[model samples]
Structures are given as C-alpha cells and as structure tokens.
Target: MRPSSDRQAPGGGPRDFAAAEWTKLRSLRSTWALLALGTVLTVLVSLLFCALIGPEFRRADSAQRRALDPVGLTFTGLQFGQVPLVILAVMAVGNEYGTGMIRTSLAAIPRRGALLTAKLAVLGATGAVWGLLTGAVALTAGSTVLGASVPLHTDAVRALAGAGAYTGLLAVLAAALTFMVRRSLTALGVLLPFLFVVSGALAATPQLRSLARLLPDRAGLRLTQVHQDAGDLSPAAGGGVLLLWAAVAATGSYVALRRQDC
Candidate 1:
C-alpha cells in the first residue's frame, strides 16, 4: 500500500482548487453582504458627490477647476469604500484560523502554496469584477448628475482597468496580511487605520507627500486620475508600484504560512 503522505488531495489541481475556492467564497453570506455594501457605498457616495460638487465646481476659482479631474470624481467613494473590501478579505482568511478550520484545510490539501494561490486568485477575480462594475456605474451616475459626458478616452479606459486592478490587489493584500498576522481583528485593526488615515494624512503633507505616494493606496489611486500631480508617477508606473506592494505581501504570506505553526 502507498504511504498516506504520498496521497493526493481528492480533486486538487489548478482548476479544482480554483473551483473550490470560488465555491467557498461564494458560499459565504458575509462575502456577498460586504461586496453589496461596497458597491452601494462606492456608487452612492460618488453620485452624492456629483450632486454636491457640481455646483461648487462651477463656482470655484480657475485654479481649483484646473486641479479637478472629472473622471476621478466619479470614483471618490473608493477612498471610503475600500474599507469594507479590506475587512471582508481579512475576515475570509482570518476566520478560517479563528474558527480552527485551517487545520482541516491544511490536512485536506497539505499544499500550502496551492491553497494560498487558490484563495488569492478567487479574491482577486471577485474584487476585479466588483471594481469594474462600481467604476462603470459611478462614472455613468456622475456624468448624468453633472450634465456632462465622460468620454471613453484611453485615460478613461485605463482608469476603469486600474480601478479593477486596485480593488483586486487590495483584497489580495488584505488576505496576505491576514495570513502573516494570524488574527482577523489584528489584521483589520492594522490595515483599516493605516490605509484610511495614516496613508492619507501622510500624503497630504507637502514635505512627506512624496514619500507617501509610495504606499499602495496612494499609488493605486493615482491610476484613476488623468492628470498627475507635480511629483506623481505616470498612471502605469503608479499601478506598478502598487503591484510591487501586493507581490511583497503575497510572498510574505506564503512564507509565513510555511514557517508558522498552523
């Protein structure tokens, strides 16, 4: 008889693992709820901003008008909306550990690499779809409210794609960080404050703003803008910077999963 250690997971391959991950994610009510809330907040707040800012925009001084990017305005909610997605992603991974299911998962697969990859792929795919939908709807709503047409220029298309990528990467980052932290609340507690407050505040200071742009949220959000700030990187470059962060986090996740006692 073959040794038990030599046995393969019942249906474990790229396709099966991906399918299993998708099923696990979709089966969770919290996942649906968080995504739904994220969509609503992203679209609704952007629409509201359109209404509130339209008149103010018209009355603003030339300098303020020059600084505005209508396309970017459509997705203003992302600054706030990303929180729920972060929490959802963290919870997804963290809950498995919190609930003592990681042991069963590791027992079932025995391949941490494959399991982590599956989880990330599913989370990324879901976030990308959600981001695309939110971007499209927010832009449409903003244009309608502001009485202007947002053209499908190259920059606009890039913004939409970048938004999707940002959403996907952010989720992946959350999941990775959760694995490294080994606790959902601890991960959430760290991520929520840093991404929301610290990063923004750091980016707002002229002296330190250049340094802050290197952060994932700051760099990632730059893709949504057609115009770059004085010291900002090109949209493509900014996206690349954000990608680097996610990649680093993912590497850490895999390493931690391997080294840590599950």
Candidate 2:
C-alpha cells in the first residue's frame, strides 16, 4: 500500500489536505494526553463548584439566592480546563515550526493558505468535539451533585452547546496567534496571562469593565452563562465578538505565514 501522505488529490485539494492534517494531528500522543487532561480538569472543577453551591445557597439571603445560576455553575471548571486546550492549540501549530517540519509541509503543499485552512479546520473540529464532551460530562456530574437545583432546561442545553463553541473558538484563536508569533512558548506566555490574569483583573475593575467585556475570553465565556448581568452582552453577541477576534487573528497569521520564509 502507498504511504498515507502520498494519497491525495492530483493537486492536493482541500479534502486531501484536511485528511493529511487529521492524520498528522492524530499521530501525536500529546493531542490525546492534553485532551484527556482537559476533560478531567473540567469535570473535577465543575463537580467541586457544584458541591459548594448547595451550602452557599443555604447561607445566602433571598436576593443572593435569586441571583444564583445553576447552569452557569456547571461550567466554572472551564476557567481551568481551557488552559490545557490553549497549550494543545499552541503546540499543534508551534511544534511544526519548532522542529522545522513546517518547511517539509510547505514543500509538499505549496499553497500556504490551503495548508493553513486545512490545519485550522482539523484543529477547530477536534477542539469542538472535545469541548462538547467535556461540557456534557461536567454538566452531568454537576447535575448529579447539585440534584434538583440544577435544571436540565433549554438554557442548560444552550450552555452545553456554548461551552463547546467557546472552547473551539479559543483553540482557533490560540492556533492563529501561534502561527503569527511562530513560537509556542511565546504564544503561551502572552495568551496564558491574558486569559487568566489580565482578563479577570480588567473585568473586575470598574473603569475597565466595559473594555474587558470586549476581550475574546471574557466575551466568549458569556455564552456559558444562563443568567446575565444587567450590562452584559447577550450570548449570541458575545459569541460574535469572540468569532471576530478569531477571524482577526487568523487573518494576521495568514499574512505572517505568507510573508515570512519557512
């Protein structure tokens, strides 16, 4: 049988490129390891958050209790879970550049845009599937722990689907940034702090709250909330903001890839 990479369209069509990219991604052990870690973290953190909610709700006043969001509680783990996914996205594209495999890839598939599109498509799909699985598991575990308090309603379903889309968009954004910087560590350095520290800090500051809401992480995560604050954007609008950020990053990455030599 011919080598798998040798099997492609006459000129390496999009489908062929996507197949090759999937093969490459699946061959890496790190991909499975990171995804597994992400799932575990998401579920564990969600369960922990759910466990606390009952006690907290009991202690709270009526107004505070009224403000509680069971659907949102199930996704509390995503704050930690998304870190591994960011690493996964960064490594996916960064590793190729790190080891000079990008040169070989570029040589085999001269159309940089086609190669990038295929890679992003595969990465985005993987992220989405993993995100959905993580969200489902977390929601199930959280519901079991929280009992009747956690409603399995339309909003819950939206939150579950939103969790998947949020993670997928985040992964694409990270990958595109990796492509632009051409270094995994550099991308991680900037992105990790921005997501974890800067975004949270900015969101907490009265002066910066509006600006913070526009951030990709801050805006995208709004999708997982069943209850929105008075000033918060609707889930659909928040998703749009994230999608715009990913698009901008992708465009910048493409420009960098096309202009720079491998």
Candidate 3:
C-alpha cells in the first residue's frame, strides 16, 4: 500500500481545490451579507457626497474649485465600505481555524501551499468583482446626483480598475494576515483599528505622513483617486506599494502555515 502522506486525495488538483473553495465561500451567508452591505454603503455615501458637491463648489474660491476632484469624490465611501470586506476576508480564513475545519481541509488537500493558493484565488476574484460593482454603482449614483454624465474616459476607466484591484489586494492581505494570526477576532482587532484610526492619524500628522503613505491601506487607496496631491504617489506607484505589502503578507502566511501544525 502507498504511504498515506504521499497519496493525493481525489479531486485534489489546483482547479478542483479552487472550485471547492469557491463552493465553500458561496455557501456562507455572511459572504453575501457583507458584500451587499459594502456595496450599499459605498453607493449611499457617494450619493451623499455628490449631493453636497454642488453647494460646496458654488461656495469655493477659484483654487478650491480647481482642487475639487469629482472622480475622487465618487469613491468617498470606500473608506467606510471597505471595512465589511476586510471582515469578510478575515472570517474566510479564520473561520476554518475557529471551527477546527483546517485539519479536515489539510487532510483533503495535503499540500498547504495549494490550499492557500486556492483560497486566495477565490478571495481575490470575489473581492475584485464586488469592488468593481461597488465602484461602478457608486460612480453612476454620484454622477446622477451631481447632474453629470458618468465619465467613461481613460482616467475614469483606470480609476475603476484601480478600485477593483485595490479591494482584491486588500482581501488578499486580510486573508493572509488572518491565516498568520489564526484568529478572526485578533486579525480584526488589529486591522480595523489600524485601517480606520491609526493609519489615518499617522497620515494626518506631518511628521508621520511619509511613513503613513507607505502603509497598505493608505498606499492602496491612491489608485482610486484621479487627482494626485502634492507629494502623493502616482497611482501605479501606490498600487505597487500595496502589492508589495500583500505579497509579503502572503509569503509570511505560507511560511507560518508550513511551520505550524494544523
């Protein structure tokens, strides 16, 4: 008889693993709920901001008018909306550990790297799709409220794509971090506060602004902005920074998973 450790379970190929992960993900009610919440919040907040833009633009001086970023304004809700996605990502990996399902998963897949890759692929795709949907709806709603046509120019398309990539990268980062910590609450406790409070505070402080801009959330969001402020990174550069962070976290998770017992 062949050794059990060397045996490949039925349906253990990469594509099969991805399909299994997708099935598990889609079966979770929380996944849809969080995605829906994120979409609603993004569009509503965008509409609210767009509604105020007219009055603000009227009150603005020449410089302020020039500084107004309609494209950026359309995505104003991302800060608030991204929280649910982050929670969703954390829960995706963390739940398995919490429920002691990781062992079963390990037994079925055996290859830790393939299992993690499958999960990340499903997560990345889901996040990207949700992000694109939210971005498109938010942009349309904001444009309607502002009495303007939705911009379908190159920059606009780039911003939309950026939003999708940003959300996907964030999901990957959150999932990798959760895998490393092995607990949903612990990951959320760190991620929520850092993304909302700490990163913002650091960005606001002149002394820490440079350092803050390098953080994953701050850097990633730059991609969704059509206008660049003084000292702000270009959209490509910002995306690269975010990608680097996600890559590092993922690598760390892979290493940690290998070192630890399920």
Candidate 4:
C-alpha cells in the first residue's frame, strides 16, 4: 500500500488559506485590542443607558411605559460598540493594503478568492462570539437597572440569537467592503457613518423611513429587539435581508479581488 505522504492533495485550498488567515489574525495585537475595545464599549454603553433611562422610565406614565421595549434598550450599546467591530473587520483587509503588505500576501497565497474567503471565515467567527457576549451583557445589565425583564419563552431567545447573527453578518459585509475599497480608512469612512448615523437618520425621517429600513444595519438590528416595532419586519425576515446584503457584498468583493492586481 502507498503511504499517506505519497498521496497528493491540494496544497493551498480554501481550508489551508483559512487556517493561515486565522493564524495571521490571532498574531495581531491590534486585532485583539480592537475586539476588546468593542466588547468593553458595548458593556459600558449599555450600563450608561440603563443608568440614565432607568430613572426616567421609573417616572414615566403607564402610556409612555407601555410603548417601551426592554430588549431594545438592552441593545442600545451595540449601536455605539459596533463602530469598533466594523473597524476591526475592515482592518483585517485594510492593514495589508495600507502597509503595501497585500503584495506580499498575494505573492504567498496567489489565489485572491481563497485569501478573501479565509479572512471572511475568521472575521465571521470572531464577530459572532463577541456579538453574543455583548448581547448577553447588555440584556442582563439593562434588565437589572431598568427592572425590565422578558420571559425566556418569549421572543427573547430569538432576539439574543439574532444579535449574534447580526454582528457576524455585519463584520462579513465590512470585510467585503474593505476588500473592494483596499483602504481601511476609506471603508471605515463609508461604512461607519452609513450604519450608525445615516441609517438611523433616514429611518427616523417620515419620507425615507420605509426605504431606509432596508439598509443592512436597520434591517439587522430589528432582529435584536425583543418586541416588534410598528414598521419592522419579522426577525426571520430581517435576518434574511441582512444575509442577502452580506452575500451580495461578498460576491462583489470576490470579483474585485480576482480581477484587480494587488
């Protein structure tokens, strides 16, 4: 019988590239730092919202209180914290381009598609873990301070799970955008404001609210709300829309990576 070593296999497939990408991400101090910052900011901002809102909520009329959603409040910190997460995801691709190390990376891997896929895999996993953690923290802290609680049997479970998916998908989209832009700052400049500021503003406007809700952040964040908003889609639908955006962005990025020179 032939030895295992004698058998030939693909040397630099997606799996191998993914492993290499994971190792590269793990080796970066900035990666760890940004992740930590995102997590910490999420928790702190959640706590702050609780501290401020809890008191006002306690004083509000029953009519006003009836409209408030505890789960929505829990996730308020994510709005701010997600900024850092996006930065981290974009930087995974952005750093290489900025430092002119993309040439070196491409020289070693040669397959741009595989490299891009590997980075997405690593970022997806990282974002999911942190998103879940941040969601749980926000939920607990907000409930404690606001004295607002939701039963486990309700949509609370879906909300929590959605939080994880939302973050992962958002990060994946950011990575794809970074690949297309080839500059961390440029990607950040576009993504952060749109997701954080512009999306929210548009969603708040009477004229554009309907169209704006279709944006990735607006659609994705809806899933994290324990109670449904008047105009919001179902959690499953919202998640699907977010998934669609990520898929499109990834496809576009793959095409750009394959066609463009490093």
Estimate every model's Cα lDDT from 0 to 1: 0.85, 0.88, 0.89, 0.84
lDDT of 4 by residue, 1-262 (tens): 7555724854667877788888888898988898788888887887888788887777778766655766677787887889889988999889989999889888878877777888898898888888998888778877788876543645666777888999999999999999999998899999978987899799888999888878998889888875566887877788899999999999999999999876
TM-score of each: 0.91, 0.92, 0.93, 0.88
CA shift of 150, model 3, Å: 2.2
lDDT of 2 by residue, 186-243 (tens): 9999999999999999999999999999999889988888778888988999999999
Output the TM-score of candidate 1. Answer: 0.91
- The parts of candidate 4 lying over 4 Å away from their true place are 1-12, 55-66
lDDT of 4 at 70: 66
Rank ordering of all candidates by TM-score, starting from the highest: 3, 2, 1, 4
Q: Top model by TM-score, which number? A: 3
**RMSD in order of candidates:** 2.9, 3.1, 2.9, 3.4
User: Candidate 2: minimum summed lDDT over ten consecutive residues — where?
Assistant: 3-12
Question: What is the clash tally of candidate 1?
Answer: 0
Which candidate's lDDT is highest? 3
lDDT (10s digit) by residue, model 3, range 1-262: 8666645655458999999999999998989999999998888888889898967765777677547767767888888899999999999999999999999999888889999999988898888999899999987777677655567878778888999999999999999999999999999999999999999899999999999999898899888887788989889999999999999999999999998788
Give the winner by TM-score: 3 or 4: 3
Per-residue lDDT tens digits for candidate 1, residues 34-147, read 988998999888888888888877777767754677778888888778888888889889988999988887886688998899888888888888898888888878767865
Q: What is the lDDT of residue 189 in candidate 3?
A: 95
Clashes of each: 0, 0, 0, 0
Q: Over 4 Å off in model 2, which ranges?
A: 1-9, 58-66, 149-151
